[model samples]
Target: MLVVDDNSNPFEMSCAIEIFGLARPELGRELYDFRLCAAEPETRMRDGFFTLTGVAGPEAAESADTLIVPNRPDTHVPRSQRVLDVIRRAHARGARLVGFCSGAFTLAEAGLLDGRRAACHWMWADAFRARFPRVRLEADVLFVDDGDILTASGSASALDLGLHLVRRDHGAEIANHVSRRLVFAAHRDGGQRQFVERPVPAVPDESLGPLLAWAQERLGEPLTVSGLAARAAVSPATLHRRFRNQLGTTPLAWLTGERVALACRLIERGEERLDVVAARSGLGTAANLRARLRRETGLSPSAYRKRFGAGPAQPTAAGGSGP
Candidate 1:
């Protein structure tokens, strides 16, 4: 993996480093041969936060299997022709491409994102669509995984995309380990809405943390929206509103997502029987598990198991036994 830096934002760049560049000796193997490349020898970072130097030149991008494009704060500023040329060549050679935040602009400017689905920061959605009308922009998503190319909606969503890439390259168990090390959620559906009613509520709103934790532990049970509402001492309508305001999803959607995730982990841990996996994950029946797994992962139960089941057991981040 190579990060192409051309006056990029430090936060998104750091997210790439943290997710792909960092060594995972705890896992007993390196995840990626990560490197940083720049179009110029001395590149000024976003808002002049700092100057980056001592990185490989643009030529390094040609050898990388994956290229992470730059995300600059000034979206209106035209990217350097040299940088654009490098991205174009890399894409021509079939290397996986990534864009974080305004990096979507850089990819689209290079003419790689036209006629392809992508995501960018919601604040720039209109401008991106206006500038590149051919690209199918999913402004509501946290990220878009269009096979070889991916884009993230915001600076923080960069981590979400990075973890997703890790899960794609490795497996759910390994991705869970890496996410645990970062103290982040193991998975956030790419289709989840990026917008929130209020980033920081003017008045403190009731937190759903306790309720969420309670529900996670009971996913194997016959959990229902009414049951969750009852547990929270709130009406079903109030629970739905809170879920939408705080989590950007409905309670039913969140519950279904959790159950699917649990099913995936169980499968990755070498559970062979579909009926057993379904029951343990609260999916109820093998037929339902098959449908939900295929919808969420694009793989049937047996296929998913075949891909992720043969790996050695990975230890937990807290030095605990593997699940």
Candidate 2:
């Protein structure tokens, strides 16, 4: 992985370094051969915060399997032609590309995102659309994963997209490990809204943290929207509104997503019987598990297991063979 630094924002650049560049000794292996390269020998950071020096030159992007483009504070300023040319060449060579915040502008300027779906800071939604009418800009979502090209919306969402890329490349368990190290959520679906209308309610609302924890602990108990509402001492309608406002999703969608995640973890832990895994995860039947897992993970249960399963099945709590 190579970070193409051209007046990059420190937060987003640091996110890429933390997620992909840092060594994961706990996982007992290096995740990537990470490097930082710039078009100039000494590039100034965003807002003239500091000078970045001693990094590789633009040519280093040629050998990288993945290239992370720069996102600067001034979106109006055009990127250097040399940087754009490097991005175009990297894409042409089939290297994966990432854009954090206004970095989408860099990719679009290079003509790589002409017909691709992407995301950028919500504040720049109008400018991004007006300038690059050809690209499909999803300003509402935290990130857009359009195959080889991925773009993240705000500074923090860069971490979300980075974790997602980690999940895609190394699977759920490893991604969870990385998230744990960062003290962040293991997963936040790309479809979730990037901007919540009231990030903090004008009047303090009851936090759903305890309720969510309760639901997660009981994911295998055939949970439902109404049931969760009742548990939270609220009506179903109120629950739905709260979910939309606070979680950026409906209650049912959150429940389903949790169950699917539980199902994936089970598979990773060597669950072999689809029916048992489904029932334990509250997905009900093997068929339902298959559909949900594939929809969420882009891989069937067997395929996911083959890719992420730890080892042979161990004994179950009931003194029987593991699922």
Candidate 3:
């Protein structure tokens, strides 16, 4: 695994370390050999008045099966040619290229993202589009898994992308096992919209935050638009209008999206019993979960599991973050 580190936030870098460096040998898996490659061979990072040293050089990516570009510090600025060259070499040699968060900028700079759909932090969506006009930028999503080229929004989305790569390499079962260990969801459909900032819709003085939090806590219980509205002490009409205005969706649609998100986590964690996955995700039935997964991701639960649920010994396409 090749991890290309830039002047990236250590928080994002830690996400990579957590996903790639940690090994699970109990299941007889050949875990990623993670390498931290620095463009200049050695660099210094400020970690709260402490200096962190970079030991690995760009050549660390030479033999990698998968290359991961972590988020860079600046989204609007162009990257160095040295960084571009490293990326080009990896791509030409058929290494899978992944950009997490602003790392998409580095990929775009290398011209690898030309004519391809890439995901970036939605906060920098406009700048990313303006800078890389040749690249098809999908601003409203968590990530994009387009075959060998994968890009993800920063923050928690990096974990989502890493788990996706795990699933792609090993299969869902292994990825789910990792998720269970990490207390995270294994497969979050990369298409969920990035939390973009928008003008708050004009609605009643009522707050949706509390209601949404309450709903999250009761995901296992039956939740309906009417039920939620009752809990929020609002009329059904007011609630629907408020949801549409504030969230850009009806209450029912929003609820379903939330449930599906939960279901995806449960499914990724090897909650193989469809009934259990459904109940946990609040979908209520195996059929419902199957239908929802299919509609959202074009894959049945079993098919998804089959493709991405294998144990973690499978060979990667190339260039992830370890030795």
Candidate 4:
């Protein structure tokens, strides 16, 4: 992995390092040869005034099978030509490139994201779309995996994308194992939004916690937007507005995501009958589940199961086991 730094959010940088760098080799399926590469030899991060020790610099990127650009401090900083050149060269060599959060701006500046769909922090979605209008932007998604290039939405979505890379490289089992080790859910359905409507408060405000908990416990039941709105004691329009403001999506979209996530769990556990999976996920029928999955991921439910449900230890971009 090649982690580019521009003195951005050290917390996100550290999250990548801890998950992909400091993860226990003994616990991990195999030792990961991860590197913290940069445009400069030595970079100073904001965390603890810690000056990161020098690595091999941009030249080190040449040997990497995958490159990761972490979130930058400023999204508007013009990428140096030298930095863009390294990224383009590495990409030309078939190396998989990942841009987490605002790091997508770097890849966009390098021109790798031209005509490609990408994921960026939704708060800056309009600016990114206006700046790179040629690039197809998927705002409602947590990430976009376009062939050799992958980009993640803001914040924790990076973890989801990172784990996805691991699953792709090794297998689902290993990815799940590593995720368990990290205390994060192994999968968060790639189709899920980067931020949900009515997220639980940061300081345990619990204003929407009870409602979310109640909804989660009954995903298999019919969940209409009006019904959900009623549970929150608000009109459907009010609920809709709240959903947009908090989660960046509608209630129906959020419910479908939860159902899809449930279906993934079922398939991973070896439920092959499409009807059974659909019913369990509250997607109603096989056709509905198939349509939703295809719309969300451009893949059929069966294909997804074949690729991700069969194995655990596969090699992914995150350096865990997956394929």
- Candidate number of the best lDDT: 1
For model 3, residues 168-204, the per-residue Cα lDDT tens digits are 5555556678888878855556766567334554655
Deviating ranges (above 4 Å) for candidate 3: 24-31, 46-54, 74-78, 163-222, 235-291, 295-298, 307-323
Comparing 2 and 3 on lDDT, the stronger one: 2
Q: Regarding TM-score, does 2 or 3 come out ahead? A: 2
List, residue by residue over 1-323, the lDDT tens digit for candidate 2.
44545567999888888887777777766666677888889988877889999987887777666788888878888999988888888788777888999999989999999988999999999999999999999999999999889999988899899988887776788788989999987888888999865566554546788899889999899788899889888899988988888878898888888888888888888879999999999999999999998888789999998877885322111001000
- How well is each residue in 175-257 modelled by candidate 4, as lDDT tens digits? 66778878886666556677675655555532554776688789889889999888988789977776666656678877887
Each prediction's total of clashing residue pairs, residues at least 3 apart in sequence or on different chains, is 0, 1, 21, 34
Cα lDDT tens digits for candidate 1, 212-235: 999999899999999999998889
Of candidate 4, the 10-residue stretch with the lowest lDDT total is 314-323
Number of the top TM-score candidate: 2
RMSD, every candidate, angstroms = 4.7, 6.7, 5.4, 4.6
Order of models, best TM-score first: 2, 1, 4, 3
